[model samples]
Target: MNRLSAAFIAILSLSSVAIAQSQPVNELSRAVVQVTAPDGSGSGVLFERDGELMILTNRHVAEGYTKFVIGVLEDLHQPVVPTFTAILHSFSPELDAALLRVTMYMDGREVNLRELRCRRNASDFCIPEIRFASDVRTVSRGNEIAILGYPDIGDDELIYSAGHIASILYEEFGGESVPMWFRTNATISSGNSGGLAFNPATGEMLGMPTSISSDAETSTSLGRILSVEAVWRALEPDRVMTTWEEFLPPNDGLDPAMDPHYGGTELAAGFEPDLFEVEVLAGGSNRIHTLPMECTGYVASAPDFRLDWSGETTQLHLFFEAFDNSDDATMIVQGPGETWYCNDDGSGTRNGLDPAITLDNPAVGTYFIWVGSFGEGDFIDGTLRFSEVSRNDF
Candidate 1:
């Protein structure tokens, strides 16, 4: 039998015991998988979005591993014989959560899961809809929760635990207080890090069980679940990308090595005027690259100007000046070391609504610059300025 069929048969054999013991385990445990990481073993919860199967686990469980093994089971105490290989897609340390995508079922054939499907009256291999609670924070203290995961004691088998919410915790981010994690009286162990904590009444997942706190004297432990809000926040493309490599690739269709939209300018430190300016029409058809901060604007696919800088400088100031003072201008600079700098409204430092960015201790290298308007499809006429002094000086 194929790996998927073998897994399905194993699940079916345990359904009888699951129905007698816990109804939630019979239905929801199919989505929980045992994840084997470099450090050790933990659990992961499977979720389907837009026809793709994704797994959610703790960062400590799956982080740093490009690939790992996961075993899917539908009942507690059922051994995970057929395993699948999963790829670590992304991780957010702030949220302490990691996302994985399944690639293939681990057999000698290396069969792809995406290509396999259930046929009418012919196969038991079928993917089911794993539902998560939309209103995650609705359950407060005293609400009963059901958890399914692979604890070390269970070996390769999934384990089910029952508990109640003990308390909710909050953290501040981006000037807002958000739900961070919740403590529960769930019996979770070292191998349960990335499993599901669900509402038994609704059969919907509430959050992920990430860590457990123990009291040696009392011989008791409290489980800490990373809130569902934190999970969604971590999954966001913008918030999860901390490194420069995670930034969005340039889509302007123009190569940085090519000639700029406007001619290139060579500037050296301690130049005669200490100021260089170029007049050009701004805005382009391409949307601005996804930046680390609140950068909203549009620019041409090709850079408007290229700056070849020489020597050391304390600060290099780049700003845009629209002919119409009311026009909202913006700027993008691809500096040395592939670092990106973008500015909108200049943080209100400029005289008007123009955008400005000051690079501190600017390095001597080539800088590809783009000047654009805050609004899309806007071709505002503006003067791009480069100076050693700040915009306040001009």
Candidate 2:
């Protein structure tokens, strides 16, 4: 090769390395926050937009409490802890996802993202808001990725793990099937749930690290990522609270019975029975009920129907059938003495995407049934049937 061509190639390679070094991985690291509960801890993303700040984490991670601490890394891996109380903004337990809004202050002041800092040259520096990939669909298997979180590595330091996308999996929810998850060879531990998974090439978030699977024999760990699209579906505009008053001190408590806006649905006592009713007999045909798009709340949050089954039946079977294979739905049966039985994504014949419940020797009394949409503003035009079955059949 000529001397001039060789010199040009070296200069281009040098510039490429400089550009790669200037990328925003350091700033993205700041967006990963440590979420702590009374029982355990996990990682959450610090989402900030238009002057509003919120944290997104797994539903299981934020379960059982309305208040927790948001930990930001400072002083060379030590955490700056701030206590904040939050209300359940929205959640889908079947999806294992939850969105909580900070409501009140307990022991410390509210989190000021500007003051939050990360370490560089034995000093701290302010970081910018995290960026999310516009479309996860563009991501293909074998693409390089990075997973960042506060893993329980005997310290509070933020851990960054790198791996490649192994495969994409399509799962059904509420009757609709979509490519909702991707598997990676990243190392994720117990505290890595809800952590951010980013495309190293662009520093854009691809998904959240929600689960990990290990082959017992090979000891190979596979990380399961909930796609960013799923996160967007969970953060539907209708489900999000627009005003701050909705999450204030008096409303910050976790009990749905006490908070009217807890899950965007009123409780059982306030709910009136639906106008339509269907009676099912043993060895009888299935009764279909159309769940309109207006059915806004979720399985644990909405009141859908009232059922009276005071017959000489040993067991009762309920099924929620969706119109499409990808649509998702939830069912909750509140029975005698305020007992509750909830099911999401039916088992066996139902492909684990529909809700089904079998009550053996259920109390012979009136049962209030509630159905909820799995997706945001998702109108489920489906059929619901209840049948009396023999105990052995159940």
Candidate 3:
């Protein structure tokens, strides 16, 4: 061969090797696990959360169950078998996602799920972590991607599908529009829900393959991916630092000192007669759609009820009590430091669909509250209650 031709071939060989080294596909695949619940089975991605190993999957896959069987892929030829049991850690019904905390192994050996590394065996070979693309805004249409999961069709083996971004969809939240989910030509099947939608070149997760859209007449199907933005917002509260500004409603120019629409009350940290309440109309012109799968409702610009708190050594509880079952209200509190807290539907037995928010060691400042309606622009009558103890205590 001529010298120039040989040099050209040598450069091409080196470039191919570099490309292969940049993308560690095998390591990324190892993080995928098969999740088996009483109702059905689906895919889950392993990630570290609060010093424990957790599996993230679609909420539908974990329906009506708190405990689940988790299995890790060992090889392609062997079927994935149940290796351990995981407990439901937390769930977001709006986001359609659930987290499972890994418990003890079948062999009785303690495992560290909090560690970044998830091992296939006792060997050093492991998937440290499945890296998620930091900013999904950078992703554009036509970007090539891959989906990894334990699809039912694959019989418990990890399946990989390749495709490209088809389109991006936006949804309105808190009066602003933001990208929510995107359509992809990638093939997402029955068991693909909650699996990783990844960028094969960089080995970064782009989104979660959650559902598939199909046309009856045309017989055409497109995969729908839950964008990382929604996923991040859904998981943000658990993190110490938060990007709440992105999800909270925009300012409507209402001052805190403005007269509360529902009137107001004052309470000290250790005040006697612990519970206080005010009658108010919930909901207004403003809509809070940005908080995906969490708080959703329409609130007014001004505070419905204002609380003059004298600071608290213990946690403070602010909740709404609907007079009847027909009303569903939401609560938004702008407290000291301008921090915002929101909640929809109280967990207490009697609270039902009423909203509640707990402020840990509430600061000594004025709190502006908005008791909102779950429906747009609907006025709801409810009682805004404040207590030092939980609503259940009452």
Candidate 4:
């Protein structure tokens, strides 16, 4: 082989291994692809093997685009962006999860993409062909989760942000920590939608950052992650990429209770005085904070409802559960200038909350703050649980 080509090969080998075994925080640009359109950018994880290729991002990330041709992780050798045939596998609008299949070049043998190492680590986790993590336990309120994506940051390269698991909203009707969503302190800039948020230990995916705080401020305080359940719901049973496939339901078939996708829920508009009492500590536990989870009516139908906020409450991810027994419909809304509003049908946070979203972000104190059913026809009938609510600044 020519000296130049040989040197290039050596570089690729070393860099891949380096990234695989270590904590390459915010280094998602390494093997992931970005979907750039006229006005936006999205992130996708690179899954290569068996001569087959694909990218995992939010369906909304593609924004109706049908091409995967971006090179990231700057050190890799594919200088010229190689275009791949992109196919939309499945999508769930409400959950905001999507999958794309990319036609790839393969030699004589099959290849599995996970074999490509990016972050160097002491342990090599043999990522299951279908790797996923569920029933996630928040180790700390400020349990940090790093994402791989275009950080809306105008730097023209992939950027990373660290976020704590902020608050978990587990509504009564919506059910179970909304395994579909998570809030974070990570700054998910303009172009970061659809990138991967994963656990460093297992290399198992946690979710993708879908939204970031859009309000104008010195710094944005909140970001959002779409859980794997979103991906499963949008994917065909045959292609569902999680531990869930073995007991895969019939196409589009779902059970309301045991299933992650569907269930009735009662949302907490906000905190009511009689609803809660606080407990401070000299030190904390595995969780940063804990909230109450049982009401009078539906104790038996409840999930864990245990609020585990680790780190300092400010750096913790507090789990919240709300019950709605008002017999009305409600919505969670975010408006401008701290004008949080709730009456009989809605809830919102205008100034942001405290404990802050993570250790880095700070509490955004705005004027508007309400969390109960608003107006008319927005309340409902059921018991709700709230993990905990604390103030934070990111």
Candidate 5:
């Protein structure tokens, strides 16, 4: 009887794994999608695009299937398993990426891609959605990054691995530089081919997961990933990347990101490891790179849904210039669970601490400043600045 009981437990464990694979997605499943390949199954992200498209999965999955199957649980009691039904729309074999259009049109039954609120709006061009890392002010070779996927995993199979970002093949990070690529320890399983690598700090979308830590050979655990640089190049204004080789380009996508003056270095946590020459002064006001906003009369601001920071006295020093006479009302500041730091006075600076503030305390590398209103009925515009540098360099 004891032996039989143990056998039952083993079977249950195996069955549980199967269920996880088929139904519930990992913590990051909101952006995950499973692709049933002729050879085997793999994973991909719900690539952000107009609802007009079905979903993007690893190209090889529906590559051979002219009409692919897409499965989605009609009800919660059913399961998170995809309903295996779709019409192939487009494919790029070179990148091993495929796009399929789901024809079922099941509305009200399940949450669809239309739910994600897009904060990024760079209307100048039509490139793949790329989110800059607001939490990781600086990126290095050792910073931890997680890759989410559903490689040949069974039903209960969802994998999450943390690894150091190793190399910046294309560029140190983002902007109009070369195609971006990063390397990490996170093992890319067979089913995780088209998964996603997210910066856990801010929940900001980084890049699509590709290649395994161990290549076709189960040899080493050197996981590699490509950044939005590759995806952006495919959609640059005039930049035409017709081939994969052309996309990879020749120059190391490092120098520009390391340049503090021109590159979007302020957007990331700190300089990528390769930027040894760049120097960042501590306690310097980051208003230089912050968005320009002015105190526009105060009101009850919805508690910021952002959970990236922990602070007792939340002071906001916006980088703004007085626009006109209407801006004379007063600069007031308020936050949930905290007192308003600045009262609506005609003072140009809101915090009242100083014309420029160095957020030296707590030493949190990144934060977001939401601009709403001044006190009374006035208007102003300013930008948010970083009070502390990620890495302290004289």
Candidate 6:
């Protein structure tokens, strides 16, 4: 061969080697585990929280089954079954996300972290925690992505496919909108559900493989990937760190439980509470805050608030007035106990979409307030007011 041709060939060989070295396929594969339910099998990503291990998968994979088996792919595509038992911790059908917590074995067999023989270490089985992409805004059309999972075609072998983002879709429901999924040409099939879609350049998870679509007349390859934001939102309160002061302040007020409103038998004279104002973006783009109150309810949007009430008596009144009347907004108040309250329009008398809540004999404790837009275009720019009322007001 000529000298120039030989030099060109040498450069191409070196470039291919560098590219292969950059991809951490082995490490990424270790984070992907085989999840088998009573009816079928799929893939899941291993995550660690507070020193305990958990698996993040699609709800359909673990739904209807109280318990399932988690196995790691060993050499020659064989799966090494760990004695660990995974129990369903939480699942959301809307988001298509499920969280499974790993409990000790049922047979009383002791297993150490090093016994799983996961990534990086031969002696230790500790699976490395997968890093999720923080900003979905960075993922744009045509961005290169990769999927790691146990595709049925692989026969229990961890498979990797590289592709690029094709299109993005937003699903709107209950007055909120969010990036639902991204369409891609990534080679995904049965058993690939719940597998992760990551940026090969950064190794940051962007989404999760959920399903694939095909055209009958024309040939097209596209897979729908659920955005990682859904997973992050479902598992946020446990993962994000914040202090009590961030939600509410120390209680300093006359005992209202005995009298109801600040004053007994009458509304408290000049009982005015300061208005707390917050700015929230549309489409649930902000971080969701946990309310100090202990109750069960869903916050449709971010920029939520909490109030601590130790001196409450019988009736509680909460008001939310948004500046944008055209913006359809909703307010939810959950607290004290199992009691929950929500309002779409405050009194239905005002021009703006304001929400008001009145609770009688509310349990004395913290209360959570969530202000959210009803659709994709609404932004939260308003004031939240809290007051105590007499039982008669209710």
Q: Which of the numbered candidates is closest to the native, going by highest lDDT? A: 1
lDDT of 4: 0.44
What lDDT does each candidate get? 0.76, 0.63, 0.75, 0.44, 0.44, 0.65
Window of ten residues with lowest summed lDDT in model 2:
281-290
Comparing 2 and 3 by TM-score, which wins?
3
True-structure lDDT of candidate 1: 0.76
How many residue pairs clash in all the candidates, one count each? Answer: 0, 14, 4, 93, 49, 8
lDDT of 3 at 244: 28
lDDT by residue (tens digit), candidate 3, 1-394: 9999999999999999767844466677767888887536888888776677878777656644567788876554467767778887766645766677888776866875434365554343244576878888888889988898888898788888888999988886335565678799888898899888888888887878898889999988999988767766665445311122432334533356668887777788887788887888788876554433344577877788888889546788888888877688888888888777888777773647888888898899889998888865578876888888887877
Q: Report residue 45 deviation for candidate 5 (angstroms).
A: 1.4
Error of 1 at 68 (Å): 0.5
Per-residue lDDT of 64-104 in model 4, one digit per residue for the tens? Answer: 34444444553332221433345554454445666666544
Q: What are the per-residue Cα lDDT tens digits for candidate 2 across 119-193?
A: 453245344557778878788899988888888873777788888999998777546776699999988888889
Candidate structures ordered by TM-score, highest first: 3, 6, 2, 1, 4, 5
Higher-ranked by lDDT: 3 or 4: 3
Worst 10 residues of 5 by lDDT: 282-291
lDDT of 6 by residue, 110-129 (tens): 54555543555443345765
Write the number of the candidate with greater TM-score, choosing between 1 and 3: 3
Report the C-alpha displacement of residue 158, candidate 5, in angstroms: 2.4
Winner on lDDT (1 vs 2): 1
Model 6: colliding residue pairs: 114-124, 114-125, 117-125, 175-374, 257-313, 293-366, 314-361, 346-354
- Lowest summed lDDT over 10 consecutive residues: which window, candidate 4? 282-291
Please say which candidate is ahead in lDDT: 2 or 6. 6
Query: Which model is ahead, 2 or 5, in terms of lDDT?
Result: 2
